[model samples]
Target: MKEIVAVLGPGSWGTALSMVLDENQHEVRLWGVDSKQIAEINTEHTNKNYLPETQLSDGIVGYTDLEKAITGATYILFVVPTKAIRSVAKQVAALLDGKTKPVLIHASKGLEQETHKRISVIIEEEISSDLHDGLVVLSGPSHAEEVAKKDITTITAASGTDEIAKKVQKLFINHYFRVYTNSDVIGVELGAALKNIIAVGAGALHGLGYGDNAKAALMTRGLAEISRLGVAFGADPLTFIGLSGVGDLIVTGTSIHSRNWRAGNLLGKKVPLAEVLESMGMVVEGVQTTKAAYELAQQKGIEMPITEAIYRVLYEDADIDEVIRDLMMRDRKAE
Candidate 1:
């Protein structure tokens, strides 16, 4: 069945997602804030800024106007970063006929820096939750590059509503992409957001000349820290052990293609945060996610040593060498 899918954002991830849906035979309207990118997608079907040679489909209509993108979109794939999610949602809210709009499927992974709010909370605030015909999270270990190439990608479509999650699971699961249905929305989201924080640590470890053993150790420890925080936030403890949790952690923490990992690598190489961000050319959710996670950990009194260490490395200008030394010599406690 062909569905009307609107992809908001034109970054690598967004363009990749839009291309996937278009190949799935859905009418995809890929909206971009970058005028040049939009022009390229419209005329040349290429967004070189993110995807260098991947040409989009005729079914994928690239537009700049908010109204033009959401006019009749049945399901919106919100692919913007955590910071831009709310603002973009607000713009969509103003342009949408709230009484009849598409199911807003958040494809982002991170808590908002300002309120530590999830993407769904922002949607509820921007548009009434009661009016949310469907609210779902699409996340996993899959990267935009792999998905764009039609590689076998597996992700979860989690929602409170069983029917909606199943409906969503069907739309995304194709020959190359597989979607699993899960009801643990909180766990799924928490896992997705938390992985990026740890990926930075992994990248930093790599930057410090750490090998696979170090990456594995950081990934496992990061999972524990994230699972602890997720359980504190009322998420299913087991979800942290599942696809959205450990699966995503392994992928992002190890992959150089991961923006968060690359950013951390840059930081480890003595590049300033500002310079690293500017060079990345796209929003690294982990940068802002670190702030939110630090806030959450502080508020909940959760002892997230890794998260705190990363926070300090990012914001407080704490030397990575000093931080690693402290982590290695921390107060001894049972694992």
Candidate 2:
């Protein structure tokens, strides 16, 4: 009933997950690239930079050395940013070197910018199959700030194999945290990655001072856009209506805690993209994800007008007002 888990990344999400594992009575080896953060977690039991005002459990130990962190660990949860997934996974491959086969689970959401591959796909590409059990993705509307404070949250653990999904479900389920399993890995991953784009749009609408009516329209149509692209990529349409799709879109788009939404809010306020990102002090995944989704939509011949509009404003020098006007002036169609 006990598992030794290696959590790669010591950010808010990673620390919050470590707390969940500690609550579930698992020995968590929390790994981080920052030596100061690791020392703080080890000595003070606090990750102040990320999760302020929270004390971590003694069952969770911090490790700076990647090799030392994962040694003899049964489960490796990759909670790093989307961009860091590949490099960290490569490190896992070089260090593990056929020593132990642990179940690989990733909580990071987003597709690689150029390749447009899901986080799970990128991990599988970097880490050999022999080094771990089949992959599982954990995702939903859950936010690190809420989860860190013991708020009730539900998320989906998806894998190609139901057995693997169930294994992950049991590992994180507890009083405040609930985990559900889904077999649609493609749908789940796409929903997880693509929702951030929609969230950015929602934040932009908010920043522009649009009220409930406009926000409702954006979220509704955003789901339509997400569903269209997701179906083209062979994902189940039903998955979009579920937690990882609509659920994640709702929370991330509306919550101030969401970096993607915050970034979009700043952009809507006419703040420069570079300044917004620099001020956030965190990875605004939606910014990069919008580019990837725009490219993917073009490649797949899927029409995603909202994503296109956001992409233009972020990547191109297009004005947000002009982009919104162009979106409204598009050819009329039945919804």
Candidate 3:
């Protein structure tokens, strides 16, 4: 059963996922803002800037025209940055007017800054119910770099209904790529977003010459905070131990392929956030997520020490060393 799939955003993750669909024998339309990049992808079968040294399948086509990309697609995969989700969804919603509704699937992971809405909520707010059939999220420890090379990877496809989740699971699951279905959308999304904050802390510890023992401790404690905040927001605590939770936290925190980890590594070396952003030339989602999470925690009266410390480093220009010392000096408590 071949279908048309529209994947928005030409970042590494989006491009890699497009390849997966292509391999699955589906028609894939990859949409990007830059005409030049689209041209490069279509003409050269490669996205040099994002997935360097990887060749995209010829079955995948790149499009700059939003309407043309999704006009007749049966599935829409949103992979843009969290900050851009709302604007992009609005455009897609307009394009979807008077057309058959498509299954809406998003792989982006982050919460809205001030509003603190999950990605699905943001999309639902902008896109009319008449124009979309369902909302599903794909998340896990999978990295684009590895997935591009056909390395083994597993992820979760979560939606309100089992039918929707299973639809996505079927489209993506194949040899070397496994998909699991879950009904806990809130937990899955939170696990995907919150883990990046911890990953930043993990990278900072590494940049500051911390050993595996310290990194392990940071990740363990980070999961606890993530679960606490997630539970406060109606997410299942058990989801934290699953792929989207601990699984995502482990890879994002430790892998050099993670943009968030790389950003934190630079910050650990005392690099300015602006400079780090300029150098990376990609979205460091964790930086913004830290602010949103910190605000949300304060508003909800949830105690998240690591998130608070990372927020101070990112927003308040607090010294990383001093923040670390303060975190260490906090009164001891049972785990």
lDDT of each: 0.87, 0.91, 0.94
Q: Lowest-lDDT window of 10 residues in candidate 3?
A: 92-101
What TM-score do all the candidates reach, one by one?
Answer: 0.97, 0.98, 0.99
Once model 2 is optimally superposed onto the true structure by TM-score, how far is the C-alpha of residue 121 displaced, in angstroms? Answer: 0.8
Which candidate comes out best when scored by TM-score? 3
For model 1 the TM-score comes to: 0.97
lDDT of 2 by residue, 202-275 (tens): 88888988888988888899999999999998899999999999999899988898988898888889999999
| lDDT winner between candidates 1 and 2 | 2
Return the clash pairs for model 2, or none.
Answer: none
Question: Residue 245: error of model 3 in Å?
Answer: 0.1
Error of 2 at 113 (Å): 1.5
Off by over 4 Å in 2: none
Position 290, candidate 3: lDDT: 93
